[model samples]
Target: LHNMRTIQHLPREKQMQKATETMELYAPLAHRFGLFSIKSELEDLCFKVIDPNSYKFIARKLREKKEAREAFIEEFMDPIDEELGKQGFTFEMKGRPKHIYSIFRKMQRQQKPFEEIYDLFAIRIILEEPHTKEDCWRVYSIITDWYTPIPKRFRDFISVPKANGYQSLHTTVITKKGRKVEVQIRTRHMDDIAEKGVAAHWKYKEGKEGGSETLEKFVHWVRDVLDNPRPDAATEFVKDFQLNLYQDEIYVFTPDGELRTLPQGATPIDFAFDIHSEIGERAIAAKVNGKMAPLRQKLDIGDQVEIITGNKINLNPDWINDVVTHKAKSRIRQYIKQKERQKAEEGREIWEKRAKRANIEISEQDLTRIAQKLKFDSTQDLFYDIGKGSFDVNELYDVVKQFTSKGRIDDKEDEDKPAPVTEEEIQETYINAARSISDDKALVINGELTNVKYSYANCCNPIPGDDVMGFISRTGDVKVHRSNCKNIHHLIQTDGERIVDVSWAKNIDSKFLGAVKVIGEDRVGMINDITDVLSKSLETNMKSINVSSDSGMFEGILTVYVDDIDHLGRIINKLQKVGGVKSVFRYE
Candidate 1:
């Protein structure tokens, strides 16, 4: 369907859109299935329709040189054909013409012109399967004996077939005429698999029409993408579908020396996830080639990766950035969202308990009122903010106080009663207050201090690593702020005694939301590239991405989850390297 040229009869706009989809979708699918002939044809047809001038120019060049190229191929094959027959092998030799898209890609990649392109065609040797390996090597020996083989251009796929089951012995040798010609040696069975891909494998396997369980896994993976419920369903499906299409597999080894196959760019985190969800969740670090490496370190063809798991299951949100596989990404996202939902629930409980202690009944009506007072779009948002320490609990109490006076009277009576509170009593009160809400500590200082209800200041967005101080508010809750925040001076001068020392708990592994601004020259696909870079970093989720372009310049604001300032810095540095990106800075 992609290779069809009849779409030209349709309207130009429709033709171009359909052509783009075919190239982005069908071409990669063909490549993944090892349908190289079809893949090349699809690419050429799409390229012709997409960029007719370049296609015509390259086609014309090939046409002008067709006769001489065929003659040269015959000259290159005759001696080898005779020698192979003399060596007691039954083989068929044929000329393989290079596809126009393949030539165009080479020119684009090498930054060369059409006239400088060499090896416009190849020679294929198909042999009987009974003695396939021996005969293929025998043919290789004959060819090398006749011509000088390029050491770097040799590939022995027979010993290591590709992930798509493509097996061929490929070599590029210099002929007597001092011109390069590629040679492919394979059996008839291998040729069938190479052309028909999964279909041929199913036919030969004598299994169900679909294929083996292994092949079914691949089919199911595709179905998973198509079934993924996303807002931009088609676009996301195509993006993920194409992502899996052109991958070259890399085989890595586990600690037990068991071979594990992963996509070429997969990292240790991906490897851990492939092993098991538990292993991936507990993976704290990894050692590649017996040396400590970052989780994002790319694995090579045969590197041995040893995952170091922690006792507690604490996955960094950033692992999504380093992982390339759909499974890893999906699992990580699921885990993070689950944690977020749990946190939101915890926050809801905190609100309910606080309201109860304040002698206020938090009915649905009260929640709606409080949400409106806090400018929250919904009660869930209000709870999430309270849970994430983004909302000041004192303000919430103040708003809810207006709805009832039952808890206010108890507080007033307690205040009026002169009670001598001892140090031990105060400590017990704090512990009881902390225990009433959640086991998770609300605030941790130099020591494990609890019962300190605090909300993060929006002015500084103080994360765990930041130098922070807490300010006691009217309702006894604390409002945390960065020590160096601009608003801290007024607080320091006016209420220095209320400032409390605070630090993140040693075991706190939660993520904090941060905002960043990216400035770059405006160009097509710039936003996609920028988001791709972000997606490959640690636990970085683009909560929102707003891009504005003017006068060929683009500026984007991205709000994402980050572990700390250091995590944000790593993300910024990565964004800086994206094409056309001029600068990346944290938005205060």
Candidate 2:
């Protein structure tokens, strides 16, 4: 339901998007539930909005054909009327033109021009209450005797009503003038049920005996569709749902003679899934009509299907394209996703092993950059490729080494031209410029006073982009403490209310002092290599660097300027890859 007032408030693009989502979801659901009126109206509105040119073309074609169609329908129904009158059948007949969207679908389905399609309307013959379905069949025989009925075009839904309780006799006959016309025969009660679906089912069958069983089966079908797990993709789900539940049905059977109804074009694999998920997963082959057949063979009406199973899951992802049922598709999608996840994990382990062997210590942020540079949608995609053997891990290692190689990039740019810097360094430069406006830009304090002095706690030396909490001290100052600081454990427990939720501001620029301990073999130029990696490679300004040696082992702690946690991590990674470096750890 599109409220004009509410829709007017949205931008044109957003309105279009909402219409797409509705068409992709609710419209197919309406059709599946036998709500023909609602489904047609919904399709009409969505078609106009989604493709106005096509809608206009179909509407114009329908309008142009209306008068001629009426004449043809009249000529076709006259002989049937005379025959029914002679047979003394109480019936109501009318020529119902097809809906606009329906005609368009017919044209597409037949792959023909609009004028070439002759069966544009159906003449309905609704018998009165006294005339039961048996009489309707007799009437159908009389009509077919007068006209040449196409054997393939006849359906006896009156014998076995549709899952949604629609009962009718449908036939397409060719007249002497070589014009084709469609006809429908049903009782008045069946007509009502066909139009109004469940509502009329309960109304006409208030105390009826046979209808209770049909209604129970109909209810069960609905529950089966709804109660199962929903598919992840909405568009795929809607298309598959329509194929499974709304389209023409084929009645197949098991070897035991039990009947089953599946969508037209359903494969034997779909029959396997309809029986049980376990059977579908384990199905290896199939037998149709007491003869061995391929599992992908499409089933037909009255075809007996038997599934041959194996001990292990014999499912293939390619079967997703062969089956038409939603349950089968959903199960196949789950298996595909599970396999991809396994491959992705394997890829990650391979990458980590290669990284360790190459002495390449890197951050996730840098890995994400390499993933983006490789034109992957996400790091997970990159890893999946690696696990599948499509991507070379050494290629990723080369990218990481270049990323930490003094902020250098190996793209096709002039040697003197400025290479594209990483997002972190760019954000740092931008934040340095933006923070010049205000001193309190480093930490945003809600409802803070003008004289509220802000200071970084010495215990953790919280920096920009560090997770922190603000505590109001007795000196009327706001002190920022790192979220993981051991010193704040007592403060959070004793004076917890004084601790307020705090986060780093994006514009924060001021540097906080951080310290890291690095241990390596005591060798010549060990301290120089560490200092050079910090001050020159990563561009970190060191406040102090101290080292002490015992025999051939040495450990050193360096206090340095840090803009954020990520910056500190990059520093540690750079130091860990230095020559003779055994380990590097940052201390709070």
Candidate 3:
């Protein structure tokens, strides 16, 4: 405590790690042990360490006028208690103090001072026992009687306990004082269950009669990580289990009365995955609340989810981004990788068969060595490149043929051909590659062949999987452009003979460089500060960064190399965590 000061500083990575460990770990553990008070305290401590400025600012504001804060809580609780009493809920209602850490986060995110952060405080409602499940509904109905329910804000976890085995009804209301406060309604059993989390289920069964076996079964699933074999296999299990332990859940249902518990904002895909991994894998579409919706559709409380599956293979990698649950996302990534590996292996086999048909004899070692030199890890990857038509087959054949024959190879082959010496020859070669409909080099846009003419568009850095089109050039060659590229619209009137159709390959290898401009209020070490955050927080390499400041505002442009769209998302999340970042987004 002596070392604690009015101001403290630590590397942002340390703060993130501390947050992941404390708030995401020990706080949930304390809750599992029925230590409600301790769990809240732990969370507050974590917030304080992670975002000190906001925490300190809020503390000072609340402490400045103790009576004002007390009056706020009283005004916050009056109507809630009146509604609970009128509904005959045997209950206890009270307000919990706002933790320093939480206040700090609110201040930082909202860019407000301590005095403006009022929602940090919350009111809790703990109810007495009800002999039947209907009694739980009775409590819910009672609370809604006095307060105008925010349609999307109500959560009914009583029917289906959360992945972490937590169950409760949570809703928020605007008090007479125009202050918004959260109200948590749960029976005595639920109160105990909520406070203790998974342990409440275990203790209820092992130490008391009339405990729930259903909850016990769920607890066993929660502990599957401990019993699982490989660390990789259980990483998701443990991560999802821990991260979701104290989450806010919504109750969704199936037509068969089977209940599905989901984190707030979960989609149909998440529900399907939660039900079973295969179900999620095959799920192409779904009906939420009996209305057909896209797989990305969000599920709400009392939503009846019906998944649609098809015999055709349509498990797309893009689905990974749409899923909300950690379990769902992890499973999607796993399946996509598995499918890619299988394709690569099949491609390798096909390439091997093609080599055999071509009378080319090469050992697996020869193929593996050549593949490694070309940035591949295995023969399958080499074959995958071959199957995807990325590598020149004629070149690959010569390389392999040479490897098997002690470097004695044909000197007259096109593999060693010199580049065209004249512009006319280059133009003719380009025309042949473009105009030859049977050639793989011809730009086929969405499977349609057109007159050869097109050049690569500059804007948006169009890559594979992106929608694209070809523009005709006066020189009788096509210029390829993303369909949405801003420059494409201006070039549509070019020579018709040069306008050929274009499309992206099924797989892409090139890395697209993206830039982001971060603007915020300036402070000491602000430039070095952002650099440290980017270097440490992000996974990909940062190619270049430029920072400048004048008139109290600091701004920087960060150029990062991304493996793909998914990696870009993680980088965006990291940038959003930087201090004083007024805005962080794509540069162009």
Name the weakest run of 10 consecutive residues (lDDT summed) in model 3.
1-10
lDDT of 2: 0.76
How do the residues 1-588 of candidate 1 rate in per-residue lDDT, one tens digit apiece? Answer: 633568777643334455656777788888987788788888888777655656777889888998988888888888988887787887789996799998987876755456667888889999975656767888898889999999999988787677676779999999777899899999887788788886777765655322365366556545544454444335444565576677778889999998776887999998997788689889999999999999988999889999999999878888877887766776677777677778778888887788778767667865765586567877777877888999877788876786565423222222334678774455345444534554444676435566556678988787766656666664556677765455654565445445455566665668787888888899999988887887764546879988889999987889988888778878988888888887776665
> What C-alpha lDDT, on a 0 to 100 scale, does residue 580 get in candidate 2?
90
Arrange candidates by lDDT, descending. 2, 1, 3
Clashing pairs in 2: none
lDDT tens readout by residue for model 2, 16-107: 44545456567766666667777777777765654454567678977887898788788778988988898899889999777777776776
Once model 3 is optimally superposed onto the true structure by TM-score, how far is the C-alpha of residue 474 displaced, in angstroms? Answer: 47
TM-score of 2: 0.61
- Candidate 1 versus the native: TM-score? 0.59
User: Which stretches in model 2 have alpha-carbon errors above 4 Å?
Assistant: 1-25, 46-79, 82-88, 107-115, 204-212, 215-232, 356-365, 404-588
Q: Kindly report which residue stretches of model 1 are placed more than 4 angstroms away from their true locations once superposed.
A: 2-5, 206-238, 344-386, 390-588
